[model samples]
Target: MRPLRNIFAAILLLSGAALWATARADDGAGRTPTPHPPRAQGEHCVADTDFMRRNHMKMMMAHRQDVLHEGVRTPQFNISGCVNCHAVKGDDGKPVSFASPQHFCRSCHTYAAVKIDCFECHNSRPETDGKAAATEIDGEDAARLAAFLRETKQ
Candidate 1:
């Protein structure tokens, strides 16, 4: 009975050591890398990466109050601005959007098990894309875009 108990304890310790080693080697170092959004053509963001990671939700809340009560819609700290700039292409080359886990927002959000409701009404991608949206905007089209922003700001 004493021999059997010693063998069981040894096995348990070995198992734990193996598991710890594998966890540490995930990226060949003791530390795991943080998740980063896909690269954008522009090398800048509304804030530095560390600052944004810590304060993004707090910033969004203030942005919400400003947009709703004041109707102030500057580009900074806006969800639309982030989505447009951080948009990552999927395997099909179409933008990976909020609907998919591959989307920039959804990646870390889902990983952290936080549920987000921002995309319930908003389109995941921006209004403009290649050639079509890039082409010269007519007066009517520009007005429509403004109207769309106003309507969605609500």
Candidate 2:
């Protein structure tokens, strides 16, 4: 009976050690990488209706055809809606002079435990003009673009 008790205790200790080792192996060197959350789907501003409504910001309404007819190409990637206006440029021709809490999306998200990775792939500034012109339309392009934006919804 004494021998059986000793064997059982040894088996339990070995099993416990094995579990500890596996847990440490899975965790690695105590600096596990945090996984980023999936990006928001669809157009950036299109799904921000609630945000726009709360902030009293104007919503972009132009359709693809309207934008093309007006000679305005929609930006491919933009973090802030209408970034051309919101972002301030410096003498160096770079976007914004300083980074703020408003711009540091990761800060609040980190506090809330939501991970974001916008800075990894996107530039802080918005892309405006392209190297080659796609098409040419009549009338004032800016005015047409504004009008087109005024008529579209998400």
Report the number of the highest-TM-score candidate: 1
Number of clashing residue pairs, candidate 2? 1
Q: Model 2, stretches more than 4 Å misplaced? A: 1-44, 51-94, 97-100, 104-113, 131-154
lDDT of 2 by residue, 18-122 (tens): 999889878763554443323332355444645743442222334334454776666532234444344544455644311322333332344344333443333
Q: After superposition, how far is residue 138 of candidate 1 from its true place, in Å?
A: 29
Point to the candidate with the largest lDDT. 1
Residue pairs clashing, model 2: 61-152
Candidate 1 lDDT trough over 10 residues, lowest sum = 129-138
How many steric overlaps are in each model, in order?
0, 1
RMSD of 2: 15.3
**Which runs of model 1 end up more than 4 angstroms from their true locations?**
1-36, 129-154
lDDT of 1 by residue, 1-154 (tens): 9999999999999999999898878756644345566775457988898898899999998998999999998788877777777788878786655555567876687556566667655556655654212323446445654554444343
TM-score of each: 0.65, 0.25
